[model samples]
Structure formats: C-alpha cells, structure tokens
Target: MWNLARVAWNLRQSRRLSFAIPPSISATQIDPSFFKRGLPFTTCKGFSTLETQESGGLIPSELLTKKTVLRPDRDIGQYADLVTRVTNFHGEDKGFMVLAGDVFDVPIRKDIIHRVVRWQLAKRQQGTHSTKTISEVSGTGRKPYRQKGTGRARHGTLRGPQFRHGAIMHGPKPRSHAIKLQKKVRRLGLKIALSARTAEGKLIVFEDLALPSHKTKNIVNYVTQMENTKKVLLVDGGPIDDKLKLATRNLHYVNVLPSIGLNVYSILLHDVLVMTQDAVNRIVERMHTPINR
Candidate 1:
C-alpha cells in the first residue's frame, strides 16, 4: 500500500515539473499578423528583420529611405528678364549683361530632340556602300545550259546568285542617307539644346575670342582656367577668328564653330559651351525669326 501511495506522489510531482517548463514554440505557433506588420517578436536564427521582409516579397524599409531628388524647372517668364554676365578672355568680368531669354526660355522636347539627332547623324553618313547587280557583273549574258537536258538544275546566267564571284542579291547600294526635318523643328531643337545647357549651368558667355597671338598656348591656358572640363565648343557670330581657330585646332577636345554652324548635335556633344556675346545675340535672333515653310 505504501509503495502505491509513493508512486502516486511521484507521478504528481512529475506532472507539476512538466507544467513548470515552458512549451517550445514551433513554426505553426507563430501569429500570421506578425508577418503582416513586417516584423515578428521571434525570428529564426541567422536571419535579420530586413532579410525577413525581403523574403516576404517586400522591399526593405531602409532601402526606400533615400530617394533621388530632382531640381525644379525654372519659370519661363523669368527667362525673359534673365541677363547673363559676360567674361573676357582673361576670365575677368566684363561687367556687361546679355539678354538670354529667347534662347533659355524654350521647353525641352525629348521627342523632337531625338528626331533631330537621328536626322543629323543620318545626314552625316556617306552612304558610299555599293554592290553590283546582275547587269553590272562581268559574266556573259548567255545561259549556262539548255532549258532541261541533264538532271542538274537550270540556271539563266553565271551572274545568278548561286555562282561564286557573282553579283550580290538585295545588297546595299550607294545612295544618300540624308534625312530632312522642317526648318521650325530644327530651330526648336536648337533652342531646346541651348536651354538645356543654360539650365544645367554649362553655358559661358565671353566678350570675344579675339586673341593677341595665334599661339595655341594662349587659348589653351585661357580655356583651362575658365572651363571645368576639357570638352568645350566655341561659337562665334561671324567667321571664326584666324588666331582662335589655329589656337583651338590642335586641341581635340576644343572645337570652334561659327554661329551658323551651331547645331543640336555639336551643342549636346560638348560638356561646356563658350560663346561670344555676338554669337548669343545671333542665336536669339535666329530663333525669333519665322520659318518660311
């Protein structure tokens, strides 16, 4: 009887001990709401909260904290009254202002720009590629064999596509790849290019490109001091000065073009645009003129 009583007491103590120990949490015991909040009180070992969020098909909150900020576009009306300061060849302030409204007020048109660039690139192509046709080939016009005699396939001439050294079939021929765009469209594209440069603060206006000597070192030293980058395009109102041309010719990154030569392609290609005040006036006037057709 005593043994039975002791066994009952032992069993009760074992039951108490089992209840005192906490139950281990299994994967199924986790609340689904914790996942919806993107965090859980208990996480698996060797994993982080961010990793948990990522594994749940959600972007990590920390990654989305930093964002790309863009500058606000300048007002069109403000450009009309805009006056840019002019600097001299020696980088000294000339204390003169040039009206930049007409050139800087234009809104950027990406589609028109793309079309103009494509057109300019197309016009530059020489299109000199040539291929001879059957008529141009050296082979005689006579047929290779009779209509149908042997088991071999019939051929009209040796110049046909099958024969070696024969004329090419549907090959490229010499022709112009030039593409024409409307004058107004071209003008607008130029304005937009200028405006883009202005907005980006890459346009520089100078009194003139006139230099004392034709030495390359003079212009190179001047440009190196004034420009932040080596890629610069100089625009002059009239014919480029002989000294300036010679000075800039040796430098691959520097280009000199008359105002008339100013196009979207050259403008966009350069990192900096340095133009004379007269050149700026010419561009504004050109943009103001109405296209004939």
Candidate 2:
C-alpha cells in the first residue's frame, strides 16, 4: 500500500526547496551540474525505517547560489536510517537489519561526546589525595628557640611550614571531582558515538556471542581476520557469556561489555565495535526510552 501522507509531505518539501531557488536564475536557468553533485534521498517519518533512495534529488540552494530568499517555516531536517548486515561467529551472512535513524545515524557532535567523556572520567576519579596541615601535624606546641637569642631565625613551632618535614600549606585535600551534566546530553553522546562508529564502518553486528568452549584461539583467529583492529569492543544485550568473557579476558586487545554497561567513553576507547543483534535492539530501545528528567 502507498503512503498518502508521505507523498503529501514529500510534495510540500519539494515545493519549499524549489521556491528556495534564486529569483534572478529562473527554473529554466538552473544548472544541470547541480544534479551530479547530490544524491537522491527520501525523508522518513520515524526512527525505525529502512534507508531509501528516491528519484528526486534534494539539492541545497546554496550549492547553486548562496543568495536566495529563505522561509523559517521550512523543516530542514534530513533523516536517513542505516542498514547493515548481521553475521554469526563464523562470519556467515545471517541477514540484513534496519537500525533506528535516531540512534545509529544521528548527526555527530564531537563537543557533546567530549563533555560526556570528561564527565565519566571525572566521576571515576578517586580524589583521595590529602596533605597534613599545621594543626593536623603531631608536634609539641612550643617555640623552636628563644627569640633573638641565637643567630637562627625565630620559629613558632617545629610543625611550621619553614621547618623540615613540616605540614604543607594550602595543599590538596580529598574531594569529589565529578561535575553535573544533563541526562539528555549523556544519552545523545551515546547515540552520537554509536553513529560515528557506524559511519566509519567500524561497527559490526553479530547474531550471537555464545561460544562452545573458552578457547582463546577461537577468538584470536576471528580477531586476526579483521583489518587494522588494534582494540576490539564486544557488546552483548544481556549479561556477558562466561565462555566469551574467559576467551577474551586473556586477550588484551579485546574487551567485552554488557549492553547496560555501554557508555560514550568505552565506545570511543576502542578501534572497532562488534555488537550482537540483541545488543543493537537494546541500544535502539534505550535511546528511544524516556528519562526521568
């Protein structure tokens, strides 16, 4: 069945884009070279649609000429879903899957990702460093020597900062280094990280991570087949499998994480991301889920 609403929306978008053309350059004067520079695409309604290419090419008016009348009422969002293949442990092609556009194909924002990473690292820091103050130091509350009697300079006590092994002044103390960050930013950072990996072709979806034995060689062989994978991140939807964990623990280049444990920092730390199909589903659901805030 054809979607009437989608067709109507597309007509409106096309009309708006056409009206954006420069007034001096009539529709007949539009350059043919513009079509070569852009690709045809269609806008979808939701996050969970398959990526589609349509006949009409949506070229920006700026590409033709910057000087043009603008309308604030036009929606400029161009969303496209990502489609990737799902393979098994043996690298067999299981099938293709459609990932949510909002989760796996969002526009990358490096600043948001950086802020979230800094937040995570700060929260993980153990601010336990401390220094003894003059009052906290153990020493007698007596003058070092008589004032002006000896050639040495007068001192209040042995625990003074001028004396050797004395307490430090204005030194570091134990405290929390964590900073406040919005929950929405953290969530968007995760999505952007995933989208970045996907756009770079470093993300692979596996059917399952379950293995027959805990042999390290099984994982080693599979990992060796990959290209330029200095470090690999394995994500599963549920609890990590025992065999998978044991097999990968010995390999320093490989790391396993549950879907619930996925964060922006961990995703950015590795070179390639290998996730199970279930993991992808869980991530998409989590991205769409609402937050308390």
Candidate 3:
C-alpha cells in the first residue's frame, strides 16, 4: 500500500512539471517585437534580426516615384562676369575689360542639350544607302521548270531569294535623316550650352577678331596667349574675316564659325569658346527675341 502511494505522488509531480515548461518555438515563428524587447528566451540557431535589417534599410515609397528635374535652379546665381581682352596678331594684350552680366544666367537644361545634339548629328548623316530589290534586279523573268511534268519542285524567276545573287530583302534605301526641332527648344539649348561654358570659366570674350595678314603663325601666336585653351572654336558676329578663315583652316585643333552657325553641337564639341564682343551682343539679342508662337 505504501509503495502505491509513493508512485501516485511521483506521477503528480511529473504532470505538474510538464505543464510548467512551455514548448520551444522556432526563431522564425517568434514575433519580431519579442526580440526587440529583452526577452529571456533562446532563439533558433543561425537566425538574426540584425542581419535582415543590415541587408537593406527601409526605403520610402515616395522616393522611388520622385522624378528629377532637368533644369533645377534653386540656388543658382543670376549674373556672371565676362572676362574680356583685346590682343593683336602678335598676342600682345592691347586692353583688358570686364563685362558684367553679358552671358545669360539660366539653369542648365541637359535634356534640351541632348535633343539638340541628336538633331544636329542626325542632320549631318548623308543617308545615301541603297539596295536593289527583286523587281529591280537584272535577272531574266523566264520560269526555270514546268509545273506538272518535272519531278523537281516548280521554280519562278532567278531573282527569287532562294537563288544565287538574289536581290536584297528589306534593304536600306536613300532618305533624309534630318530631325526638325522647335525654334524655342533650339534657342534654349544654345543658351544652356553657353551658360554651361560660362559657369565652367571656359568662355573668353575678345574686343574683336581680325588679322592683318593670312599667316597661320600670327593666329597661332595670338591663340597661344590664351591660358588653358586646348581646342578653340572662334565665332564672329558678321561674316567671318577672310584672313581669319585662311589662318585657322590648317589648324587641326581650331574651328571658325559665324555667329549664326553657333549651335549646341559646335559649342560643346570644343574645349574653349572664343567669341568677339560683336558675336556676344548678337547672340544675346537673338536669344532675347520673342518667338511668334
């Protein structure tokens, strides 16, 4: 009887112990907040909250939908100084002057610049590619085989794609690749390009560009006086001086263009832009002109 009583007591103790201890939970199954709080519980091995958070930080949804403005001028200044100088054919400095607020101080428009460049490049393409089609080929129109008598498959003209020396299929033809752009867009592009050059301190203004003689050495000597100039694109307001043209023609690094020929492509192509006072005035006037529509 005593031995039966001891076994019953031991059974009750075992049941109480089973109810006191809770079942083990996996780290993944535990609530994330539980780990944030100092809970005295062991998590499953190889699971970490720090690892997941460190992999990628929380990104706001609004940031993903935000668009970048091509011409953002929140803190850009309104006016800039124009460095001006007059030099003779011998590169001697005749006079120095500072023109204030000469170049336009507008925000840079990268998109407009890109479009203008693409349009200019497109217009330059000759697009003279040509190919002969089946109809234009010089093959005879006679049929090669009979319809019913021959065991071989029936054949048509020799100009067919299956035959040798066949006409090109869907080949290119001559056409113009010029892209028409709006006048306002082109104007804006030029302004942005000029502004960009001025902002980078690459714009140089001259009182005038004239040469006494057509000697290339004289022009080279004059250009060598300009500091930090690698490749030069010289622009004049009116007709290009004949002497200047002849002097710059042989120069591989120097290009001469009239004020009317100043475009975004040519402006951005060269490292340094050398413009005469007349050219700058004409450009500013052209840019200020209101479009009809």
Give the candidate number with the greatest lDDT.
2
lDDT computed for candidate 1: 0.78
In model 2, the worst 10-residue window by lDDT is 46-55
User: Which of 1 and 3 is the better model by lDDT?
Assistant: 1
Per-residue lDDT of 107 in model 3: 74
Model 3 CA deviation exceeding 4 Å by range: 1-103, 148-151
lDDT of 1 by residue, 1-293 (tens): 99999999999997875564345533344455545774423223532333443345444344232333333455542456466779877878897665667677677789989999999999999999999988999968998888897878888899877899998999999999998888888887888898888877888888998899999998778767754685899999999888888888899988999998999999988999988989998888888887785
Writing each residue's lDDT as its tens digit, candidate 2 over 8-53 gives 9999998886776655555666557645644433333431121122
Ranking by lDDT: 2, 1, 3
* TM-score (C-alpha) between model 2 and the true structure: 0.73
lDDT of all predictions, in order shown? Answer: 0.78, 0.82, 0.74
Q: How close is candidate 1 to the true structure, as a TM-score?
A: 0.73
lDDT of 3 by residue, 1-293 (tens): 99999999999997875554344522344355634554222233432223222223232222122332232333343666555576434556768755445345667778999999999999999999999899998979988777778788877878987778988899999999999999988887888888888776677777778778899998788678777778889999999989998999999889999899899998888988888878888888887778988
**Residue-pair clashes per candidate, as listed?**
0, 0, 0
For each of the candidates, the C-alpha root-mean-square deviation to the true structure, in angstroms, is 16.1, 13.7, 17.5
